[model samples]
Target: MAGLRARLKKTIVLVGMMGAGKTAVGKALAARLAVPFLDSDREIVKAASATIAEIFVRDGEAFFRDRETEVITRLLNAQASVLSTGGGAFLAAHNRQVISDAGVAVWLQADLDLLWSRVRHKNTRPLLRTANPRETLAELYKTRDPLYALADLRVSCGADYSIDDMATAVLEVLKSRPDVLEISRDG
Candidate 1:
């Protein structure tokens, strides 16, 4: 929606597992389309002055999730932009409804092994803080797969795909939905 860049008629929300590259790919996609890139998790941390893990440890996941829903609903209703949501953001029916109403949700589908490899070393994910984090991640993956599939669109990723590659793939998929997104050229 800026300059000669692509025009986004609605918000584009990236939703998936922790290591699904939502924030990384969302930033690239927003830059490619010349739109704002906003991460709900980052916004939450900024507002609460604490990390997600800290929030979960203090106020609990339920509180963090409540804040997540509020931030997501507010961002989705803002100007057209790229919104990268938390992994569990779409698992909630209320958040899903809000996203569906004001934006297009894109699930960055990736296999569990790839997701594990990407997130195994991250201490920021409170959900994976278990005796067997890998097993926990697998459980989360299995439980959330069906929910993530309910997204408006899906963009598959692999160990070989880079952030730019995923962004390009998402753009290719978005090209078909001219009502939501459109490529523009200036004379």
Candidate 2:
């Protein structure tokens, strides 16, 4: 797939755990396809003029989620780009519907251990600010796995997969459906 031009006809919305590398992989995927990259979390922060943690602390998770849903809708309506969503965004049924209708939802599945190793040092995740964050993440994983499984595509994430590697993996999977992805010569 190297040096091939891939067209993302519909948005490629990444869904999964926080440490599953959605942002990194999304950027790589967008760059590889020569399309715009958008992160739903970043868009929410920009719209609210505050960090996600600050929004949660000031308003609440519900308010923040409302803003998340709105941002997802607005972005989907705005353009077809590589979009990385917050870990919890797909947990909302309405969000799932909106994404399903407008784009291909790819779940970047990673083991709990892998996810923990990636996010343990990060203070950016508000949901993991608890005293027992690993336990909380495990719980979230157990519940969200079923929902994430509802995605249009699934890519397993492991220590061996680099950001570009994951992006290529996504393209390989997309090969099955040319309606969603079309590849041509770079020049």
Assess each prediction's global lDDT (C-alpha) against the native.
Answer: 0.93, 0.93
TM-score of 1: 0.96
Per-candidate TM-scores read: 0.96, 0.96
Ten residues in sequence with the least summed lDDT for candidate 2: 1-10
Candidate 2 C-alpha lDDT tens digits along 40-107: 99999998899999999999999999999999999998767999999999999999999999888999
lDDT of 1 by residue, 1-187 (tens): 2355578999999999999999999999999878999999999999999999999999999999999999999998899999999999999999999999899999999999999999999888899889999999999999999999999999999899989899999998888778789777776
The TM-score, computed over Cα atoms with residue i paired to residue i, of candidate 2 is 0.96
Pairs with steric clashes in candidate 1: none
On a 0 to 100 scale, what is the lDDT of residue 127 in model 1?
92
